[model samples]
Every structure is written in C-alpha cells, then in structure tokens.
Target: MIKSRRKLWLFVGLFFSVIILLTLLVAPSRNQLMSGSTFGVAPDGYAAWYEFMQERNAPIERWQKSFKTLQQNYSDNSITLLRVYGKSAQFAVSKTEREWVKKGNTLVNLAFQGRVTEAPFSTSHETDFGAVKIETTRRNTDSFKAILKDDFGAIIWQEKQSEGKIIYVTTPYLAANAYKLSPGNYDFLANLLESSGGNKILVDEYIHGYKDKETQEIEETSNVFAYLLNTTLLIILIQGLVIVLILIFVYNNTLEKKKI
Candidate 1:
C-alpha cells in the first residue's frame, strides 16, 4: 500500500511538470518586445532616410525601400499605413486625392482610409504638438503617435508644429548612439507636449509595462485516484469491525464441531 501511494504521487508530479512546460511554450509573450529602443545602429529606416535626404545629398532608392518594411508590420483591421515615396509633393498628384486640397501647406484628407466612418483629419480633435490630431484615443501602433509603436519598434514620425512640416524620421539612432559626433541631430527634437503641458516621453527606470505573465490555474479532477483514497481511508476506520466479525464466525464453527 505504501509503495502504491508513493508511485501514484510520483506519476502525478511528472504529469504536472509536463503540463507546465507545454503551457510556457504555447503561450504568447506577455511584454517581451520594446519600441523606440535602438538596435546596433539607427532605430529605423525612416530615421535613416531623413538623415540621408535632409541635405539632398545621401539619396538612394535602395535606402528608401527600408522604410516600406515599417508599414508591413501593422495589423490590417485596426491600422492603415500609407507610404508615399519620392518628393512629398507627388502625394497630391494621385486621382484619389482630387478631393483633397492644400490649405496653406497641410494636406487635407478628403477620403476615409476604410475605418468605421469616412473620417477626415479634424482640427477640433488635433492636439497642439503630439502624434496626430485625431480626437479618439485608439490603439495606433504605427509611426503616427509620439509613443513608439510596441511591435519590435519601428520608424519614428515627427510633426514640427511651428513649421507645419511632418518629418517621417529615422535619425534618432545616430543621435542615440555616438551622439557626441552628431550632437546636432537632437538639436531640433520633435515636440510631444500634452494638451495639459507635460512631457509625453515615458522613460521609466524599472520595467514599467512589463507585467508578469497571467497563468491560468488548473482545476483539480476528482478521478479514480481520489475515489481510491476515500475507499482506503474508510477501510482503515472499519478494519477492526471486519476482523472481529471473522473471529466470531471461526469461534462459532469450532464450538459446533466440538459439540458434534
């Protein structure tokens, strides 16, 4: 009995161990990836492109192709990322953009990008100097917002409010790494001021957003083993009664034989 109980417990432990290993491998990451963080060099292609083309000197089509990589990372249902290559003026030339007209300088949105509604850019919703001027606080993991898109990190887009020029940036990597050489890169940093007059950059020392993985508790099953344990315990309690009844029967049989 002791050996059997020990074996049962050993099997149970082994089964539980296997389940734990499988759960970890199958589960998605809790908060593994970080954005706006630098790689070995520049953070993204857009920043690199801006760095190259800022002086009209480091022009390369191959270099521009890297920026396209950023658009492919977006989820199709929630976000729609549109990239326009070459000079920014060519954006107005498309037939679909006929409804859109330049107001002083900013490109007015005439059509919707297939969302719930055909929403255009609203000045009412627009902030003083943030990601975009949209009123709703939706989860946009693209280069639109001042916050870094949390998918393995990507391009950094900047809108200069004073100049009314939106810079699709890729220059921060140089600024971040070996900043002493190109100290001027950060001289005109993108302004991400909140409507309440506070800095929006959330650079915390500890793992701020990295929360612990939510593990589901396994429900214990009252199976054959549990039933056996109950039966065994009941047997131990009534064991004396069973022994006494057997002895009484043997004693009665012996007395009858003696009388015969």
Candidate 2:
C-alpha cells in the first residue's frame, strides 16, 4: 500500500512538472498577431515602438477604444496614429474623427489600401519593400500628395482631407519588428513622427481587436494557467477531495496492518 501510494504521488508530480514545462515553452509562440497592441512582445507586435517612445519620454497614449469613441474624447493638441493591417474593409474612421482632425489636430492613418472617405485617393504601385522609394503627389493639397515608395519607384502616396493626412504604404512591415531593423525604415518612421509636430500622440489599438480593458483582462486570464487555477473553484475542490481520499485510505490501511 505504501509503495502504491508513493508511485501515485510520483506520477502526479511528474504530470504537473510536464505541464509546467510545456506551458513555458509553448505559450510564448501563441496568439501573437502583427499590428497587435503595442504592449505585446510578439515579433509582429509594436512592443519595440512602445519601448522606444517610453525611452524618449514621449507623451504617448494607447487608445483601446473605437475610433468613434476616441473621437468623443479627442484632444486638438494631439496626433492620432492608426495602423491597419490586412484588408481595410471593416475599418472606418467616423465623421466625428474627421471633424476632430479638421480642427487642426493631425491624424495619420497608415494602411496598404483604401483612403478615408473624406479623402478619395488611391495609389497605383506594387508592394515592394526591398527597394523603397517616395515622391510628392502632383495633386498635392495641404501637402497631402507626398508619396513614399520603394527603391523600385512604386508610388506609396499620401492624401489629405482638411487638416488631417492619410498615408498609404504598401506594407506595414516598415514598422514591424523584423523590418524596423533597417536604418532607413527606422529613420523614415522617426521623420514621419517628427513632422507630425504633436507632442501628444495617440495610437489606436481598437482596430487590432484589443478594444478595451475588459478584452485585455480576458486575454491575460486566458494566457496564464495560474489564473485558470485560481478562478476555478471546482478544480481545487476536486484536488482537495482526491488528496483527502488518499490520506484516509492510507491511514485506514495502516491501522488494519497494525491489528494484523
């Protein structure tokens, strides 16, 4: 009985140890998306940019609400930076946001395709990062015609709507972790920010599926196994019952052996 009990405990300990090892090894590689919240450390995440801003003591805010919601609380002295990956079908900057931008607050929306409804402009070029080039647009109004391109001279143009600006880049890789390593790409981003002339910058995280504090909380709970254990009382109760049963059985068997 003693040997069987010891073996059972050994198996349980090994099971838990394996679980811990797998969690540590696998968790880091999961749920990471490009253009995710700047807080994430994934290769596609903007964590590097977040840390860079912090190091520079830049007055930056991560806006986790929808564009409409953010416009409701918009400030004229700040610059809004919105990055959209994949397709631009579902993302829309509300008229309120446009009105907010028209009030002299700069809004920079970076995406691969489509312009804000307020600015009806399109680019004609291939998406090539190997040879990046840029040019100023001929229809430039309020300097919105400025175009960024690859070395291949593909036009990545900028469009203007009132006082706000919309920049359409071929790829988001310029700000991504792997591509930001290039000195030219890094300088391009720095120049873009410097030109915005707003000390206060707000980055939109809502479009990346992290819409609010509640969503963030859910992500944290889902990622951590310790959180799961703490929140599930039934599992704890079952574990306690199993332990109690094992102890009771061992005690009763010992008592019976002594009588023999």
Candidate 3:
C-alpha cells in the first residue's frame, strides 16, 4: 500500500511538473511568439537569430529586469532591441528611458505586431545588408530617415535623439523563426547590430514577464495586496485551503467517537 501510494504521488508530481514546463514553453499571447525573447521557438520568435549571433561570438546579453535597473547599472554605450505591438499611447517610451537613450544608447525598436499597415506614402528600395538583398519600402516622414522600406512603409528607419539614436524596424519578426527558411535574415540582423556601434547588445526580456529574483522580490514587497492577489499565488492558496478542509472533514468523519 505504501509503495503504491508513493508511486501515485510521484506520478502526480511528474504530471504537474510537465504541465508547468509546457505552460512556460508557450508564448504569452497567441499571435506573439515571445516576440522579444531569445528562448521563443514560434514563427515570430528570435531564438534562431539569437543562436546565430551567439555562434558568431557577438557581444550580446539578455536584460530580464526593469529598464530602471538597466539605466542605474549600465553606464556604457549599449544597444537595446525592443518590440512593441503598435503606435498606441500605451507603448510610448517613458521619460526616464528617453533620458537614458538621450545619454547615448542605441534602441532598436521592432515596431510591427505581425500586421499590415496603411502608409500615407510609399517607395521601394533594394537594401543590401551583408550579402543578403532585401526589398524594402520607404515609409518615414521628414522627421524620420528611411533606412529600408517595403510596401507598408519603412522596414527600418532612424530617428535622432540628442547624442543617441532610435532605429525602428517595422516588423518584429525580421529575424524570427522564419530565419531558418530565409537565412538572409540572420545576416541582415547581424549587419544591423554590428553597424549600431554599441559596446554590447541587450535584448529586453523583462517585457516578456521575465524578472530576476531581486526584482521579483522588490515588486512583491512593493504591494502586499497586489502580491496576495497574484493569479498563480491565489490558485495555490485556494488549492491548499481546499486540501486542508478535506483533511479536516476526513478527520472528523473517520476518527471521532460517536457523540450520542
């Protein structure tokens, strides 16, 4: 009986572990294949590109904490790659981050969210990055310089911000899983990063729900009620309460003597 119970518990443990693992493997949203995460394997993921860069000995690293921490710790000239869903106000850069960029950091903004855009004007150009030839579109205004363009507009563009600059790529999936099919993407991205003139490359994974232990602890401590209300923590708490209640009911029903 003891052996059988042990086996059952072990099976349960393994089953739950597998469940958690699978959950972590999936992207946060159906359309977003962990867009900015190097660990993503979906069509829109950067895993392929990240691996390619790593093999070539690129100076790259993943930033899995808040940008505030980044500004505080990194004083040197660095390049950050970021992906935003749209031109909405919610995706606007914060004042502190703008200041960080103004201090001479290059921020590569992958702007598209796997959707088509209606541009006011358009022009086509064949951009040769490395040995790869990409047909791009011109989609920027007088304020922004078009680097590469497609039918929808600029695939890559440049905007000056004091001593630093912000490079915008219309498609977030430029060097995604598709890179396996179109190997030119690897070369294109490699060339882009190399030309950025940064000491290091930082891919922002903090935007993808990844945080260091200290950051997590600090966030939890910042709001007691919010921490208690976390979905995962709430689920665990409820399950534990249910188990305790079941144990109490079983004890009362099976171990107590007859009252009358």
Candidate 4:
C-alpha cells in the first residue's frame, strides 16, 4: 500500500514537472524580454523594424552576444546598431566596439541621454517628431544632420572618422515598435541606413543581458533554477511536504486498521 502511494505521488510530480517544462519552453526567453531584437515583441522592442528590414532583404543581424564576441566574428565593414536608454552604462560600448567602428565600419548609437562617453559629438539643435523628441549634434561642419520639413532639426546626426562613421540619435523611439509606425520616424531610419553604406548590419543585444557563447549555458541554467526558486519553489515544496505528511498519516491509519 505504501509503495503504491509513493508511485502515485511520483507520477503526480512528474506530470507537473512536464507541464512546467513545456510552459517554460513555449514562453519567451529572458534574452528576448524587453530586447529590441526581431524576436522580442515587447512595446519598447524593435521587432517591427527588424521584420521590415528582413522583408526588404536588407542585411540585418541581431547580435545576441557581447560586443567583443561580435567584434571577433563580424568583419570591420559591418554596420553595428546600438541603442542605449536610461543610463549610458546600460549599454556601455567597449574598446572593441570603438575599434570596430574605427576600422571602417559604421556605428549607429541611439541614446536617450544623447551621449557616448567613448565618442562624443557636439550638439547643435533639437527637434520634435510628433510625440518623440530628439537633440541633434555633429562631429564637424561637414558631418550630416537630417533636416525634417524646413525648420525642425531632426535628431539624426553623423560624425565621419578617418575610416568609419558614427551616427548618433538622441531618442530610440525612431526605431521602437510603438513609434516606427509613423511615416516621419520610418523615413528617418530609412534615410540613415541608406547613408551608412554597409551591406551588413548588426544590432547589439548585449544590453538585454545576452551573454557570450562561453558563459550563456551556465548563466541560463543558473538563472532558470533561481527564477523557479524565487517564484514557485516555495509553494511547490510546501505542497509536496503536505502530500508526504498526508500519505504518512493514511499509511499509519491503514496499518492500525489491519492490526486491529
């Protein structure tokens, strides 16, 4: 009788475990959450633009790893896209990224703070695009700055280096899922990409907590267990304990009955 009860509990546990595993597998990955990648469908994500680029057969790739890793894999000719929000530290550019751009590649960085510590440009004007606002700047007098209509200065600006070019935008809403629908926002991005003159485009995903291949497996494993423990393990363990206690009580009562 005890053995049968144990088997039943084991089956129940396995069933729930399978269900949980399936749910997790079907759900969005942590890397996709709030990430501006093609896979991410979040409000702040750039899924729309990603798909649009795909449909147009534009050379766009989501770099779901460290900038160092991307630097190693992609050639210097690839155009790298990076968007920073809140604090610049959230998506800090390293020496690898700077060198990559310096080696004749284009780097488009859109920041809410309108600053890149490693490479700074001088501000000239500010502009509004419907609900979005942007501050524009240029590296030199010859550097490009997109003008909207005739008066408003569009947030887009460019700085030409000896080998490469650095384009900075004050706001990322131009490419975000919510604002990309606007014609002005869409046109601005189209023009920027055209002027960059690169066949390969790499959108940085490291800011969304994506790690390099070497550390990804370990971090994912640890993160999953930690998430389960924090969110569901307490209740699951309590329920399991109660089940075991009830089973013990029932088994004891059965033994007492048999003896009596």
Candidate 5:
C-alpha cells in the first residue's frame, strides 16, 4: 500500500511538472514592462522610431553595450542618441562617453523633463523648427546655439566640444512614440540628424537595461548558474531530462507493483 501511494505521488508530481513547463513555454512575454526599450511597445519606447529608421534603410543601430566597449571599436563622425531623465547616477554621462564624443562623434542628449546639469554655456537666441519656436534663457554666448524653445525657455541647445558636438534637446518627447501625432516633430528630428553629418546613427539601448551576450558574460564570469540560465539549449535539455526521469520512475514503479 505504501509503495502504491509513493507511485501515485510520483505520478502526480510528474504530471504537474509537465503542465508547469508547458505553461511557461506558452506564457505571454513581459517586454512591455521595459519602458524606453526598443523592444518595448510602450508609449515612451523608441520601437516605432527604430522601425521607421530601419524601413528607410538608414544607417542606424541599437547600441546594447557600454560606452567603454563602444570606444574600443569607435567609429568617427557617428551620432549617438542618449536619453536622459534627472541627474541620477545611473544615467549620468561617464568620462569615457565624453571622450568618445570628443573624438569627432556627435552626441544627441535628450532631456525630456528639462532638468539636468547646466550646459557649458548658452545664449539668448530664438530658433524655430517648422511651426515650433524655441527660445534660450541665458545671455548670448558664441559657442552655445539654441535650436528649439517654448515658454519655459530654451528646450534645445547645441555646444561644440573639440572635434565633435553635443546637441541637448530639453525634451525626449520629440523622438518618442508620441511623435506620431505631430509630423513636425518627426521632421525636426530627421533634419537635425541629417544636419549633424554623422556617418552612422546609434541609439543607446544599454541604458535601458538591454545588454549583449558578451556583456552578460563579462558580468557573470563567476556565476555558472547564470550562464546555464542564459543558454536556451541547455535549459531545454534539462527540462527534457526531468521528463525522462519521471517516465523512468513511473515505469520502474509499475513493474514493482505488478511483481507484488
């Protein structure tokens, strides 16, 4: 009787394990939870713009690694779009990134909330993009040029640094999915990028929690479990082994019961 009960319990466990595995395989993805990511479909995401650029055959790429890695294989006259929120340490521009920009690359820094470290310098100048007019608050400076403005003052400013330039747009909304409602925003961004004379355009996805396999490997060098978890084939093999083991147990229990 004890043996029969044990067999029943094993069978039950096996059946539930199979069900759980199947459920996991068919479960809905949680990519939507990742805001601002190119894979995300959220309103704040750049998926739409990314797709649009791909469709246009534009020389654009999603940068899924760190700026330090980017520097190792740096391309001259490239444009990098970096979206910034507040002045948090997580999003703070590193010294390496600054150096990368100095090497004849353009950095399009977008700050939607308009809260960031003060620009190197700026000027009281009015610049308009189609029907959208932008104004600068600070006194006129030779190096800083205002590109867009609103009642809140200069929403976009450009500053030259060494061989490259940094264009600060006080609003990330200009390139977000919301731009679909306003065609002018799309035109303004397109023109701005084109005018930058960058040979390639790179959207920084590393800041949005997307990292390449090489990056994951570097971060998880000492973690065997993490390495196994990241291997799809190994995971599938492990699941298959669990099912096979359950089958063998059930078969052995059935023969033992028959003998009894």
Candidate 6:
C-alpha cells in the first residue's frame, strides 16, 4: 500500500517533467516580441514612440547582458538600434565624414555620433537630392542589421555616415535598416507596448532608462534562466524530502504492524 501511493506521485511528476521538456524543444526560440519595419513613412507628421533611457541608477552591464541573452534565441537576423549616445557612437555605423542635406521641410540628419557609447543621435539635414533609391554600400555590423524589404528600384544615391551602416528601403518612416530590417542582417521585430507610466513599454519595447525608470517584476529573458535553475533545485530538494518522508512512513508502519 505504501509503495503504491509513492509510485503514483512519482509517475505524475515524471509525466509533467516530460511535458515541460517537450515544450522547451518546440516553442518559438526568441524573446523578440515584435517585427515590422518603420518603412515607407516619414517621421514628420507622425511622432515616433520609443523608450528613452535616462540616467537610470542601474548597472549598465546587467542591461547589456539582458540584451545579449535576448539576442541569442534569434533564429535569423534583424533588430532595431535606437542609437545610444549616437553622436560619438555613429562612428561604428556611418562610413563618411560629416555632411548635411535638406528635405522639403525636414532637415535630414545623416551624421554619425561615433562609437564611444551606446545611444541614438540625429543630424537632420538634406543635400542636393530629392527621391533617391538606396544602394547597399556596407553592412551594419555583427550587432546591427537592416530590416526593410529589398523592393526599391535601381540605386539613385547613398549617404555615408561615420558608422558602418545600410539604408532602409523606403521613407515616411524611421529608416528600416536603421531601426528594424536590413543593415546588419541581424533584424528582429519588437512588440513591447507602452503600459503604465507616461511612457510605458512591454517586452520588446526597449525603454530608454529601464534600470532607473522603474522596478521590473518580470524580466522574461533573465527570469527564464533563473527560474529554470531555481525550479530545478527545488525539484531535487523536494524529491529528497519526499523520499525521506516515505522511508520514515514505511519504517514506522512496519514497526507499528510488527508491534500489533
């Protein structure tokens, strides 16, 4: 009777463990929650939404690690780089020296912030050109990639920034290659949406000052590994306790029956 009960619970645990292992093998392997280029649209009439990281009193290394962990699950290439301290960091992206150009009313900035820090920058200028088709001159880098579709016609013109970069296909939107699809070839879509604060963001939405902005309860990327480890330890501990309890119960029962 004692052995029978123990076997029942053990079977249940083994069955659930198998289910968990199987699910891990089949789920979409990535933390990226969104995908879609900000192409064919201008950042003029519409105000673009992005999570701004201010002076957050958080460890920068922790944030970088979190970002890296998320990137590892990617099955392909593509990602949005909002630019961190882009003025100096632009050097990692743009290929040419500093220059300027003018749009109808918007001054298109095409200057590199140089790669000293991780941040975004803008030069908003326009040169002697109107509607131009972009040609691939270089790749974004191991860390960045373009996300726009290869649909634009013949090449018309290209702008070289200090950073090794690629051009997104269309306009009227944040250059896709700069934000989502093509440049570095490491492109992925983000779906994190704004939730509470005046500027709220979800999973994929990269917040500007995430570390300093607020206390996050659920860090999906980091939490997964942590949870896996903790849960595994708990399982082992519980199993040991369970087995000890069972042995004691059996011993006690036998002694009681023998005595009776």
Tens digits of per-residue lDDT for model 3 on 115-151?
Answer: 3446532232344743333322334444467676545
Descending-TM-score candidate ranking: 3, 5, 4, 2, 1, 6
Model 4, 1-260: lDDT tens per residue?
A: 68757865775676577557756765556644565555567666777877877877777777777666666676646565655342223345566766777888887776653433322233222233233322233222222654331132335566666688777665555566765555446545755675577767767666665555865875677886765765556556655775666577667868876998
Worst 10 residues of 6 by lDDT: 99-108
lDDT of 1 by residue, 1-260 (tens): 46645655665565556545655654433322222221123332134323533444321121112212322432221211223221111122233222121111121111112122233322121223332322211222354544322223323343333322233432223233333233233332322211112212112111112221221111124445644564445444444454555556556656766888
lDDT of 6 by residue, 231-252 (tens): 6555556556656766676678
Question: Candidate 3 deviates by what RMSD?
Answer: 7.6
Q: Higher TM-score: candidate 3 or 6? A: 3
TM-score of 3: 0.64
Pairs of colliding residues, candidate 3: 136-149, 136-150, 137-149, 137-150
Report the CA-based lDDT of candidate 4 relative to the real structure: 0.59
Residue 180 in model 6: shift from native, Å? 9.4
- Cα lDDT, model 5, residue 206: 77
Residue 55 displacement (Å), model 1: 29
Worst 10 residues of 4 by lDDT: 133-142
Q: Give the residue spans of candidate 4 off by over 4 A.
A: 1-37, 84-93, 115-154, 211-215, 218-260
Top candidate on TM-score is 3
lDDT of 2 by residue, 58-106 (tens): 6777877666556566565456565635322234556766677666666
Clashing pairs in 1: 46-169, 46-170, 47-169, 47-170, 47-171, 48-170
Instruction: Count backbone clashes in candidate 3.
Output: 4
Supply every candidate's count of residue pairs whose N, Cα or C atoms clash at under 3 angstroms.
6, 8, 4, 0, 3, 69
